[model samples]
Target: MSTPLKPLPAWADVALIPLINVAAAFVISGFVVLAIGENPLEAVQILITGALGDLEGIGFTLYYATSFIFTGLAVAICFHAGLFNIGVEGQAYIAGLGAALAALYLGFLPGYSLVFVAIVAAALFGAAFAFIPGYLQAKRDSHIVITTIMFNYIASAIMGYLLVNVLRVPGQMNPETPGFPWNGRVPQFHEVLAKIGVHWPVTPFNLSFLLALLAALAVWLVIWRTRLGYEIRTVGANPTAAIYGGISPARITIVTTLLSGALAGGMAVNVILGEEHRLILEYTAGFGFVGIAVALMGRAHPVGIILAAILFGMLYQGGAELAFEKPKISRDMIVVIQGLVVLFAGALEHMFRKPVATLLARRTTQPPI
Candidate 1:
């Protein structure tokens, strides 16, 4: 009789795999630093000092982390369901524009209720934008990567035209909509913290950081505790097997895509509601694209995504400073670092998987008949 196959390791049990990937990324980053003739230790110190050197720096780090949290989680959700979503950029753009329009025109409501409405509208628009691609994929078997990338271009052009024509403020020469009303903005928590002699970061970090933490927790619960999540995972693991077992892969795919888009939409709360309090041409600034790298490095785990998000946030905040302080180091160095992290993580998975399976098989096999 053939021996039964052992189950694959739980994510928690294989925790070292991600750790190894992160460690390898750092080593690779160090090499890049050396190749550029910079002392890796000094570069690291600068990065750390710039990210957390002072209260202001810490505040900035948190600000950046907030956006990272949203996009990273967006990417993570689809990845968990074995879907590759590359449309976060477009989704974010549309969502931000939607929020901006709501805040500008809908803020006339008598109470603070408009704030919640704006957020919901943004999320809904993002979901709708994503649903189109999801439906096409489910119905026609279209490749998600190609469709999503095309959607990104379509979103950018559409948003651009709207901003230049329909959404343009009466007097503003710039390609942007009117600033959001006071009620629509995320309150400045830093000012309150300052009264106690504690300064919050002026960057994207703020109440959104807490929101990101809560989102991560919620995602973890959904994935590990819910029947829907089980179905998603089942389909991800093997669609034919899941179909035979009564799970609907198409439904799961569409649901997963919608959820991913909603997360991307939530990112606008930080941009249009928190920081800029308005929608601008460069509002997304590529955070959506960065989410892909974050998700890959995190391996699509909620907690892992949070940690990876913070790391990317730090790189973004610190890299800006590095460019300003040491003009010799290009801001593009951050991109290089991020790319290396993704590469190391992807490569490490293959490196470890074969060895791990071989060892496990040896351990489980019967030695003698």
Candidate 2:
């Protein structure tokens, strides 16, 4: 049998490969743009400029990135423990009730304190919701993939019932909670800046972006700098070996799902508390599903997740502007491009790995005359 190729350097594994995938995705997308009678070069320029051209654009980009960062972290943590937790969407959905309950009822506390309560409540709710699947997987031999998939449907039904029958404001005809009071609001970035005499564009971006970054740092510390992280990685890499070493796989599974669901719950800080100021029907808007692509593209690393999240943010914000600027390129086309990026960056992520690794190996081995 032919010997397997060694892994690429860490830097290449993390950054270079992703960059190549993104570039290939863009190239293929360019062909699509050309086929549709648009100048591919101009489209690229427009895409970049639209995402970064102005303060508002930048703000919106980061706003989109914030929830994605939470979801990405959620996915990354469970991947470390070798679990494919697909219920982030549902977990986040349920977490909204926690955020909304705190925002709607806890109006007496100081602004910061109230927001803090909401954050904790959201995480707790999400963790509780995810606990069942984790327990089933660990103790009952239920497949996590199947269970989480079913959980998504269950979450949707539960949320739909609550929104329509229970949480709807009196005679409001909207499937949503009452709007939060000013005290319950998470400070928007522009509002915070204006208080300090710096004028910033009013955008949905808020303090949660900073929270996301902090979450990323915490994930890195937990996964790479702690005993639990080592245990998680060990169990994930080889559960048989982990069992031999006295590590309990069941405990890890339950703990990993708890942490994953908690991270997923953090999305409420960005969507409900930070932006919407209320829990609305379908508030997730597919961000939880997008997290899968972000995690795959990010290689389940915190730093990589952050960068990958930002790239997707660019796609969203830039895609909107592109659709507006070019009538020929509809929102559907933008979605097609997004699909291409996801395809190359996620599902086909490792397509070029062997060739690239082989090329690097040959170059490293070449001797000077």
Predicted candidate 1 versus true structure: per-residue lDDT over 247-358, tens digit per residue: 9889998998888888887788887788888788868989998888778777788877877788887888788777777666788887787777778766555555555555
Q: In model 1, which regions exceed 4 Å deviation? A: 1-15, 194-198, 352-369
Error of 1 at 217 (Å): 1.9
TM-score of every model versus the real structure: 0.89, 0.97
C-alpha RMSD of each candidate structure in angstroms: 3.9, 1.4
Q: What overall lDDT goes with each candidate model? A: 0.80, 0.92
Best by TM-score: 2
Question: What lDDT is obtained when candidate 1 is compared to the true structure?
Answer: 0.80
